[model samples]
Target: MPMQAAQWSKALLADALAPVYLLVGEELLVLEAADAIRRRATTLGYAEREVLEAGPQFDWDNLARAAAGMSLFASRRLLDLRLPGGRAGKDGGAAIQAFCADPPPDVSLLITATEWSSKHESAWSKSVDQLGVQVVFQAPRPNEWGRWITARLASHGLSASSEAAALLAERVEGNLLAAAQEVDKLAILHQGGRIDRAEMERLVADSARYDAFKLTDAAFAGDAARALKVLAGLHAEGEELIGLMGWLVNQLQLVLRLASAEDFASQARAERLWPAREQLFRQALRRAPRQHWLGCLARAGRIDRMAKGRESGEPWREAERLIAAMALPRGSLSAP
Candidate 1:
């Protein structure tokens, strides 16, 4: 039913046998998991990978065209229908349902959605999970972020000393996308396999590329001047305010998770936390209020929606508001 991202074979899973591959989740890892599924399907003679967006404007017949033509390149074909949350809707949903009712028996049907919620149900996600595989790319919590960071670095065939690992984890927290990037940069600077603390501190300490991380650090430290400076610079550098708020939310969540959990091992057990990130989590726990992260999420969500053109907010000003709130001392924020 639920398959680990690593356990599922991309090629085998993408073969012509499985008709529906429903990748469900909003997490970056989940998105990458879908990418893996697609790549594997390529090896199994899946010649086509077309994206069909489902909206009122979309044509039901176009859904069929995703795999309509016979491939001169290969026999097997892949029809990727980017569903409305990977669920069947009015037009394409029914077409997809019909296709599933009596599958093409040749083409592999792949469906992907942002987040799999408990609310909606449709023939598309159902069939995908039943016939195909659901690779979970759940977001790693703050506690687990460290472990994931370690594994990610290890995967790149790189190693960091225990202290360096902890520092990196602290600096990056549990944000995998950011952590992965840091790893990539460190890998580039590392020259060889070994990456030490001075190197990590030197690379991460720079606020140019990773201003948000630095800003959050300043916010936690209650250094308003530093936080504002980073914020203004980040804004100038084309960094979005809502995005920074999102990063703050992520850090806060990790801190709470690590603090509440029985031990640092919870991060590893629950979210695959790394050995080096314990101190960072501990430090975060000490500096910020747990609710600050949640508040940041709510605010960021609204700001993010507005910025996306889905809702309304002066994006730049909203970021200033968030930064102002974040700059407040941990003991300062109160229940609202």
Candidate 2:
């Protein structure tokens, strides 16, 4: 049955009667669920656990040893095998088959790895499916991201304004890592209490990785086309032109911060500005001038006016004009 990381505990209430359970996925939350189950089982008297991580030089003999070893500590033994590559080799496969043919009494074997494509699922995979529970992990969809965020917040005993959640869903745009970071930030600041939209606005607006943060790179590179391309994507996403202007201003601020870095390694110190891509920002500042930021902001202002006015014009064209002005050298264009 399909299950989310948060729901695994409920599913396991009945399924825990089984001696073994398997989890597989790239989602970090899924992996954490698998670990939680293993710990719970360990507390419930399944001792003598053995974990095999599949990597170079991993051999099948370990499985043989696990199956054959007499439990020195507890009545039941648990094997948590992590095969990131998804299958064992010839010798390993045979060992696995033998273990499944007649798994020792009170010995539970759990397996985990990345999911295999239909055509690529290994024989051992089928064998494991027939023998035990298999939990597969898939990334949450766009609609599901909001639910995941809410679930995560509740898991920590927290709540948020519906507007706050809505804005988070809007700004983060289904990026799990970004969502996770935002959740963590809120959790800490609010102390697991209620979070409001004002707090969300204060903390997160532009996606640090891609959103309005990227303006100057396009400008400094003198590629008006690329600058406009970035703006076009943001515009298509329904971002307000004023919102873009605000982020552009923030990016200009980062340029000032970057220039203040004392030396090479001080690039790390520059993290205070962007905090997300300090190294990249430092590199961009190497060839760009602090004055360029003011220039970019001026151009962004004109674009904002065009967007707010009844230009009856494509926002992207105004964005292109903005990029063109920003891409030129500091004095290349007069101030707005």
Candidate 3:
């Protein structure tokens, strides 16, 4: 059965061992679930751990081989498989189904994917569903965030008044990773005492002031200074680089799609540009040529690799450069 992240702990306590587990989501909840699974597996005698990243060039045979192989010392092994693109092509699908049909008793498979659309419900997913557990991690909604924050605080042996929890929720703005870090910081600073609104106001920086959408808006308005400021603020606030890059890639793709239209009016209509944002899009389109946006998209891919530590050089500096190239006036890209 598909389970929510909140249900994972209790479920694990009830039945900690499973032949296979599939985790799908992009939120930090996925990370927490993975950690919980690992901890429980460790306790259940899955002493050997093997991790594999299934990327474009990954071989499906390796998955089969790993499952078949046995650990030299440990009787039981844990297989941690990560599919970054959340896809198993034809070959991968077949392998997954085959494994599901007769999973190795000595090994436990924990498969994770960043995305899972309707198209992902293939034979492999169905096999996993019938054979093991599937969990989906989603962020809490606005109405649920305060309670989420309060629970996170309690985990650290810290309590907060309702107002303080709401303030913290507002400050983090639904970013669970940021909220978790803030809760940890508060636990250290307050030494596990109750927190109130005034202390929250004084201690918590307004990291929520700049989000990906706001940064994109600033860039689309050709406000290079403001965009750069937001970029710095988000980085300082410990915002996830992958989330930031994903937004930039999406915005650039939208612009590229519209730029190919017959005229500005047609493009605007195709993009469903609201009256408030039409001018901003127009200004953005005018400031740079289509080729510039294409280059930005290409660089966004490189920045993603950099952020993941797959490529060398500083990711943040490259991100700043990409933002300036897209957001600044064409000739003023080198401006301080």
- Per TM-score, the best of the predicted structures is 3
lDDT of 2 by residue, 1-336 (tens): 334555566766653435445577754544556656666676767866777876768877888788789888647888877776666777767777777778777888877765544544566656666776666766677777667677777766888777778788886677554566456555555645577888778656444334454455556545567577777777777767766666666666666655665653345443532222443454356546666655666666666666677445555565666567656553355665
lDDT of 1: 0.63
Relative to the true structure, how large is the alpha-carbon lDDT of every model? 0.63, 0.63, 0.77
Q: What is the lDDT of residue 309 in candidate 2?
A: 79
Clashes of each: 7, 0, 0
Error of 2 at 114 (Å): 3.3
Off by over 4 Å in 1: 9-17, 65-68, 72-74, 84-87, 161-163, 196-199, 207-228, 231-336
Please report, as a residue range, the 10-residue window in candidate 1 with the lowest summed lDDT.
274-283
**Each prediction's RMSD to truth:** 14.2, 12.7, 14.3
Error of 1 at 69 (Å): 4.0
Candidate 1 lDDT, tens digit per residue, 1-336? 666755655435432547776676654555455555666776766666666766557788886666566677667777766654544566666776667776766777777766567665565556556666666556666666656667778877888776678898886555555465567656655667576788678767755546665676566555577777887888787765556656766766666676567655446347654322442344345566566656755765677777778887687777666666666644343332
Top-scoring candidate (lDDT): 3
Q: What's the C-alpha lDDT at position 14 in model 3?
A: 48
lDDT of 2 at 145: 68
Cα-lDDT of candidate 2: 0.63
